[model samples]
Target chain A: MAFLSGLSAFPITPSDRGGHVDTAALKRLVTRLCTAGVDSIGLLGSTGTYMYLSREERRRALSVAIDETGASIPVVVGVGALRTDEAVRLAQDAKASGAAAGLLAAVSYAPLTEDEVFEHFSTVARESGLPIVIYDNPGTTHFRFTANLVERLAHVPGIVAIKNPTEKPEEISSHLAQQRSMTPKGFPIGYSGDWSAAEAMICGADTWYSVLAGILPDVCLRMVRAAQNGDVEEARRLDATLSPIWDLFKQFSSLRTVYTIADLLGVSKAEPPRPILPLPALAKEKVAHCLTLLEQDLA
Target chain B: MAFLSGLSAFPITPSDRGGHVDTAALKRLVTRLCTAGVDSIGLLGSTGTYMYLSREERRRALSVAIDETGASIPVVVGVGALRTDEAVRLAQDAKASGAAAGLLAAVSYAPLTEDEVFEHFSTVARESGLPIVIYDNPGTTHFRFTANLVERLAHVPGIVAIKNPTEKPEEISSHLAQQRSMTPKGFPIGYSGDWSAAEAMICGADTWYSVLAGILPDVCLRMVRAAQNGDVEEARRLDATLSPIWDLFKQFSSLRTVYTIADLLGVSKAEPPRPILPLPALAKEKVAHCLTLLEQDLA
Candidate 1:
């Protein structure tokens, strides 16, 4: 549970166009997160293209990540799939492979009811026995988790935490407080939208399930650490300096932008799976310019 | 292209919990569509739980449907998948199995761009050599096809038709006209939402890609025939008679409601794939009552 609270860096699962995992490249990314001392490693998350990869590829990515972390950093694997049975198998794979927990999203194509989603979460938790972190990513899954649903799922045994989509900066406090009041005491509430995550953390969020942290953990760590240490000004300053990057993320989605970032920084040159083309050259150039400006501003 | 017109019956691909295709049940459903004289069979569609089934199961379903139809009715199989390569492969499977065409939706996890979708559709059509129908079911795929995008895709070779979600009764005429004007001449534009499809057909849309017709093809065919024969009074009257069923579809999605109808009518007893639980007892009772009312009215 403690591992669920802090900068849980969500790294992409590098793969070829066929969705075969690049284990060597994945291990490199995990090692970078470990080396930078991210509080936990969020492996195979949305940013990891978890929904796009095959079960074998997902397992391969997790194995490489778990091997790289080596008990030093807790690794939470994304176990979402369109089928309940498939999700259970993925969670079981994560559990048997030594993952810390399984992040389960209500990945739907049928536009499920609340009761269906409840049963899905309960069944996955019961069957897999892997602790669950409710992954509320409406942008991809298209199923938004109500605060009421989150509160209900919180009480389900083996369901430990939630990764909420962050609200705007002005609403983070009330959103965090309402979630706190609704759920059990000590239930970790994390936020993901990278642009607003720092404010969420500063407003006392438990974790930042970050895409930005996946590629550039060092700066993310500094901001998270500053927030954790109660240095509000320092955290805000770091966030302000990274505004250009956030703008790029907002404009061209974090997943696409991060892929470009990983390539630009010589971390990994893997293109996202097809149907999600690499950022066009113009967008890549814009991302590159942001990185240069970020380096100068941080310096 | 002619096969894409008139009443297209979309039957559920009955499958067990493990995602194995219930080939017998599925063949029975396809046989029913053919016997009812539907123009085409929309196999493995959203109502068919296409996204929930595995690749092997999808292939099995398509094979069974194609075999059952036996060149009598064109089978437009759903070939949608999250990845482009996988979609292309599914389209290839459909083509190899003698499916008439592939139904491709912009099934997304990364929340694709218009360009990405354009590329996805173009690639699937070009690579598979199977005629493609743009399955624009935004309710499930969460990717809306802009009129402009549809206009663009219409010109792509081998991309033949579109199955659009119906608009409100008052808007159906203009909506149909707008789509007709935007796309190239002779591009088939069909409507799917069952309640509104009668109105769309009367408004001169090319097809009614119907879920209700999958089970009760006779009633739907009568309506389509009435609209085609310029009997507006008869078509509207038939639409009014089926209003109860439409109410149920609106409340509990066409997919879930149709599953219960399939079971209640003894066409298929297979439950939908898991994570999409069957309707609760009360909903089932309501469906049964509606069927009783429908039988008396039709008689």
Candidate 2:
């Protein structure tokens, strides 16, 4: 697949026009990503609005992505929920869908203590042989994982990488350094915060969940490769071009903006699943500007 | 079963030794509440840890509380979920459990916008037929429900009350006044944010959700009665004993102290459902002290 080493946009999969799994469009999207040289597909993930999809939709989406991508790239499915049992069930579902690994968010109802977090991850990791990315964005957990917790979490088997919270670069660097040191050699340590991809890579994050990669895959892949090659000048230049999309993410809730921008780009034009805020008028314009830049320049 | 109007504990439906629903113990607890003359039973609710329990467990807990209490008081069952369908299902389940009404926390995903919040409450309210209470406390939601949003939501038919967030008295009051002006005349608005009951009551929040009520129902009811009777001085003195309990809720990420205090007081010793944090050492001591003081000085 030549997909394991570079960049891919964590594309937000659109809901079906008829309000279910858009399997046909999903195949089209998969074919598009494959055509664009996206290294991986994080299907039915946070970017794909995993929480909004029903259990059946999640399974269907993953199956379709796997079928269309056809063993070409690894698919990191996001298994997040308020129930560990449900999360584990989804992990098994992901496996059956031909997932390469699971990006499991530690779903706690009443914020779990550090020990419970360890247990939550450990339990899920044990259920599947697939390498599990312990998604440690405490912003969702509402219980931040401290450096000590990271040290402790690193020891759990099948815990291959950490997709950490990095809205702030300083905190991102702190996390990247801690996880990098604690992780075994060649273990994937990724950043979910794409805003600071260059710095995250510079600080130590080897892999990233790039939101921009969905619309601007070539640009995102070029930047990641440039950073990986230690070509700082080239990485920064590409990042500058992708800056408008990055700025738009800051204008709304990061997760919601991922879908809003996708909708604007024609890559994913379906309505956001219910209970998610639609982009505001001002921000919708910003999304248009960003999409225009991508279509005319980056794409 | 002459439950009066005032603050009362959210009863934790005692699980049998092997984690089965304990109807016998539940009746005993009801006997105690009846003897103590509590205002109402908050059952199959958060203190009830409703989400962690299976739908069957939720039904059993609510049915037992209702069967024993037998229309002598109101039971507000907490119904919340990540999806509208589940919330509606639980709301119907709450009605089946013989609850007076269902109190719904906003869906679990972070940053619920105004539209999502409106849909969440409206969906639950329309389906339940029972009176509705919108539980809006960011301590859990991590996303505040603005006054404007609440004002709009207050218009949903069959919605009877607002469980308003009261972490700050002045802020809660400002919102309360705004909501009251916009809402229907009879819509009851309650306050959440422990240890602020007196201030909440004075500042247009006529109803109070007392954490201490879960353990020290007698004292909590008395305090609410005192406040309702225009005896602010007496209410303050009663509220004084609850300071330690509020301190404990603030101390931990897991909120283990909430359930532990209930256990220590001999109200009902149901183990916290999984994914909950354990009470920290100092918080446990503080909770114990609060329970002891309630028994000695108020209960």
lDDT of 1 by residue, A214-283 (tens): 9999999999999999999999999999999899988999999999999999989999999999998999
Model 1: residue A188 alpha-carbon error in angstroms: 0.7
Give one digit per residue, the lDDT tens place, for model 2 in A1-299. 12234564576666753348776666766776788877787776666778777678888888888887777778888877665666677888887778988887766556566787787777778876666777776665577878787777777787777676774666777766666687666666777767788777656566767776765577778888788889988888777777777787765766777667656656566656655657878878877877777667654
Q: Any residue pairs clashing in model 2, and if so which? A: A9-A213, A9-A214, B9-B213
Best by DockQ: 1
Predicted complex 1: CAPRI docking category = high
Q: How well does model 1 score by local distance difference test?
A: 0.92
DockQ of each: 0.92, 0.40
| Tens-digit lDDT track of model 2 for B68-120 | 77877777887776666777888898887778778788756555667877877
- In terms of lDDT, the poorest run of 10 residues in model 2 chain A is A1-10
**Could you say which candidate leads in TM-score?**
1
Clashes of each: 0, 3
In angstroms, how far off is B29's CA in candidate 2? Answer: 4.3
